[model samples]
Target: MARLDRGSVSGAACGPDMPAIEVRSLSFAYPGADAAVLEGLDWSVPQGAFELLVGGTGSGKSTLLSLLKPEIAPAGERTGDARVLGENVADMDVRASAERVGYVFQDPENQIVCETVWHEMAFGLENLGVSRDEMRRRVAETSYFFGLEDWLHRDTDTLSGGRKQLLSLAAVLALRPRVLLLDEPTSQLDPVAEKNFLHALFRVNRELGCTVVVATHQPRPMLEYATRAYRIEGGCICKVADIASLGHREELFSGEVSGWGASRRAKNGVFSSASGQLDSLGPRGGAPGAKKGLKSGKSAEFEVQILSQDDSGVPSRVGGGRILQKMHGGSATTLSEGWFRYDRAAGWVLRGLDVTFSAGAVHAIVGGNGCGKSTMLSVLAKTAKLQRGRMVRGAASAALLPQNPKALLVAETVRGELMEWASTCGYDEDAAQERAAQLGLDGLDARHPYDLSGGQRQLLALAKLLLIGPELLLLDEPTKGLDLANRRIIARALCEHAQAGGTVIMATHDLDFAEQVADDIAMMFDGEIACMEPPTDFFADNVFYRA
Candidate 1:
């Protein structure tokens, strides 16, 4: 039956009082581990309800979600029961289980399998043996719903981080599963894209009666859609009467970091932790070089208000703001572009773009999805040269921290992965261990890189790049998967890098991080730098990227 036609499952899953999912006394631990990551956990989600699950970086949010879906559950010693639709998930028929329970992984990379957007959208339908007519109908409806018609034929590999995330969700939702499990579904999305996705997800729960359980570090975006929330803490789940009522201090940050201009003093690598101590979740704050007050709302009277520079190329208008402002001016052509795109027929991802960054300052590039931020970084890092136009660089030693942290992780153990370049980079075990401690990787040295949490892998990849000690660093969404505390860890690392005379440039949708750490906030649009200013002036005057 068609999902829109059927409305809801109406039977076992949609029964008024039936638990769509139930867990009791469940425990899970990786092989040869000291103790269980989760223990004696009891949780349940009712039919037709929208549930939010919030936790820290490695607090087992992904692990629990994977366990709920039997096929992809991690290898580990397990105990107790995890049931779905009144059937023990481990014993249920694989195909039936997959069709009924749809899972959208935390990382978009984990969910997308096909090369093209259209193929990915129909991949699930084909597996379920849907008729060709039905598959085409579902694909058409979902693409239009997602506003993906413009790029339905586009290659999935070329899509931006936020776009890839949208494709992943659209693909799973095409199948119209009875119960949907999502992990940080909007982590990569920009402000507008995030809002649209949340609206669509809400419809899926309300119109389709699909039970939704989302695990996120930042929960502010979906608070309105959430009916009730449960927090994963200390190996068990605790119900929170009000997700929005909890203050930033107590909510375990509950998914992604909040506070638009929230910041901390980065001094001697001693940035204050909002999450109690180093190894846990906390309110990530601003660095000494971070801008404190970030404003929002669009300005109708918007024009380019570029910061002027003196004859020596130092910024002429450094304010007495709360953070340190670097002086290097237009001479810092952090992003110098002419004209470029992936294909001859495709529109330019970079065209007539020029932005400067100080030699020893941290800069952030903010833009909507597919605004050529990643392409610009790729060109600057010399990973991909611009096809048509000039891109000037510092000729200093450089390294790039990719949006996908897994790209850098190759070895089996965390320590092994970080030390993979010890011989060539002159990095010793002692230095590697110290670097790990600095970034809060203290107890995870022996674990495999893939075995670590999404945020952990993000940090691990960054650690690998920092070990090589490049004079110039290019980061593509460094904080995409981090929790509040780990966000602070990354901020401190970048600030320290800049203070050590290394240049830092990052592309991100995180307004908070851009304000907190970047000396200059540059906004990209239609493959060019529409405007550039210091954090304060940038956030104050921008029309599109104010969030």
Candidate 2:
């Protein structure tokens, strides 16, 4: 194990005492890449400074963080010196670096190791040989700091995306590192949770005196709390003297039409269900109360029977009523009396609830994270069956895109990966190549999937699903790691598919995305379908989404 000599750095050169972090001409590439993702980059974080790293997709922000922790570099791509605590990182072993600098990865699943929330929080300390009593004190302190004490005994897997992130942060805090490096920590969190998280992070930096560095596409919240901001583009970083100069910056990020008739900053708002006279609009005019959707043309009995089909497309239950009476003429799939239970949970994630999803619809499932949006999607995708309930008149074919796109990508080369999925979807060789080219993945097929950027990996996942040619597509937080451009591309793709008679159901916290791609929206509140309707009405009068 390599160790740093205390005398190597003279007086006031160690972290907290000196700079918390320092990098000099750091460049890194993956094993097979020709160009370094981070090329001759130099950066430093002064003690107690709260800084933000802003960049577009594939701009090397993540790669730089990886270099700071020395985790994601390919075996041979790292060069130059990186110092954490004024000690050269390359000379320090992985364990020492982890202990010195706390890193929260862009993906929460990548860092989650324990089953229960308490166990996950205790993991880091236990690994470092902290005693049980010490671990308990630290876990309680960190949990209380992040407002996670209520759920301390909850199963970690059952938490919502935002809650899971909080747990991840709590785990890192328990280790008590002097520096915290966060990569888009708010990406998966809902607006409320995201807001709370930012405040907590501020407290940690201000009250605890920890150096903070975060990489994000949306920079508003960061700018609000950040003392310094650096913009990274084309592998270069430049300091922004005035963050306000980014100007009407929120509008640019969210791209949503606000009441001000201007694009709202996409990052700050939340989607909510409304119950006024919204439906009075009749799906055309501006109504203030009651959400609108296709009315049941037939009796409830008939609708339930047709929706209760088994895996082989046969209805397991029969009901008395006119078969086509409930057919509202639009594509709607529903699960009646749906219920799902996990191993460690005392209650079901979904409990005997009736939910409906229509084709060409853009629905936003809004509940505190862990409200069962993912579980509901699983039933819709047929990946997991509900402990109870029957689905009726579902799409002819469906494709599911999981939150962790990385796991779905298994091919050695990007092109080969696309081809593999295409073949699985019953496409011919020539057709797969054509589809790959159409998806803007023509030349890079030969490149390894693992070597692609975060955005590229997500696009690849979509391409794989599209190759299957399903009539209905389910995407879970598809925009989590994407920038505006790639996110728009994805939205366009989903829209085009819907236009061509395909259906889409996306579960996301991106209110901007909900406004852009959804024809209709559904807000799931506490495992119950609180309200479902068009996007216009969904946002209308909803205080949570106002600019």
Candidate 3:
């Protein structure tokens, strides 16, 4: 067991007492890795304070979170001490540490272990050996707090990404841990749900007095609730000024909090930017107003161009191009009177939805969780069959990137993953490397896919998808866990793809990414397309949908 004996450091801002968590001279390196992930890091987290960890992909934020818990801490070479609640974390028993510190993983699907929401919430209590009556009371309270009552009896698999994540949080909180650690818990959620989840955390901290620490790439919304913020870079954690003191700095408000360019000293206070490299994309045009072209009041439409060129200088007769000519004379795909559901007993997920996706355009489907956005994308990609209605596909072939990036990763190494896709697509090794570089995945060739950060895994998946060169590209939550820099790179890549006469349909909760990249926006509601229009009109007309 390692312990640190150091005098209290100033500027803790937690409370005038021993910090909830303290680390001194901490350094760690994974087995077989060449360089240390964390180097001589010193950090203090105040009791009952909401702390946020911000960094680019692979900056060791998740690794730091893992070290906070003894039960699940990664196997690594380490030096120095980490204390949780005045006790050496390394010395604590796994079960005891777990009782005091609850961790929620980034992937909710991976974290959930029970069949139903009720069972999931009660699992932790059962492990702790709580009496049946006490377990029921705790589970009931947590489920209500998280608004899971309606679906408490539903199968875990039936819930949406957002709901599953909420369930995961509720399950952890059921244990009543004093310290809560979350690693990008909202990475799979939409903007509205993300805001809601953060608010819930704020309540947990304010009402329950639980110390909260979250690691996230998207930190703008959470910033207002954060008492302190830290940036991880160069294998160390540097404390930044509180979010309140930063004021209306556009960079801070713009969701680009992954360390502004380079670190610099501040004289009076901590200064940081919410802006990122992608800020240069400039402002978009258009105003909020009623749009034409929809008779069903349930759907909306936008005009987009399809650009195609080949050896014969004629559009290739495959994928979106082939489907375009037949559907709407030039559109990529059309869904008329579409109805779908996972199971007949589950009821309809998409109800009489009518929508047309333009060819050679970047189209985004925006909606709340479980609104059939993903289901519609699946139908377009030909992954899901339309239970009822007609889907006319102009595309001879298409590529779909599922919400879970790990599903697409089959190769041992990043380079091998891209090469495999290239080989299947009849492209050379150089082409794969070029595409990888386009997505900012240039130097990660030798790294294992699973070893990469969540954002990096997403980028690798995008690289593979792009290498296939499908006419129509379907992406689900493409920018979920990515930093602003990588988001900008992906936005640029998607725009270039559209310019080359390719089609892109992305179902995402990232309004910023959609605003920056999509030419048209479709808002899905209650298993139907509530409206579709230019980004400006769509956001303006719907007050709640605006980010």
- Tell me model 2's lDDT, rounded to 2 decimals: 0.68
> What count of clashes does model 1 give?
15
**Cα lDDT of model 2 by residue, 95-213, tens digit:** 67656789897778888988999899988888888899988888887877888878898877777777877888889978877779988898788777788899989888888767899
User: Residue by residue across 343-414, what tens digits does model 3's lDDT show?
Assistant: 978979999999988776788888888888888888988889998999987666788988888989999888
Query: What's the candidate order when arranged by decreasing TM-score?
Result: 1, 3, 2
TM, every model: 0.84, 0.81, 0.82
Candidate 1 regions exceeding 4 Å error are: 1-14, 246-335
In candidate 3, position 398 carries an lDDT of 85
Model 1: lDDT to the true structure: 0.74
Q: What's the lDDT for residue 177 in model 1?
A: 78
Q: For candidate 3, which ten residues in a row score worst on lDDT?
A: 262-271
Judging by TM-score against the true structure, name the best candidate: 1
Name the 10 consecutive residues with the lowest summed lDDT in model 1.
Answer: 298-307
Ranking by lDDT: 1, 3, 2
Q: What overall lDDT goes with each candidate model?
A: 0.74, 0.68, 0.73
Question: How well does candidate 3 score on lDDT at residue 462?
Answer: 89
Instruction: Return model 2's CA RMSD, one decimal.
Output: 10.8
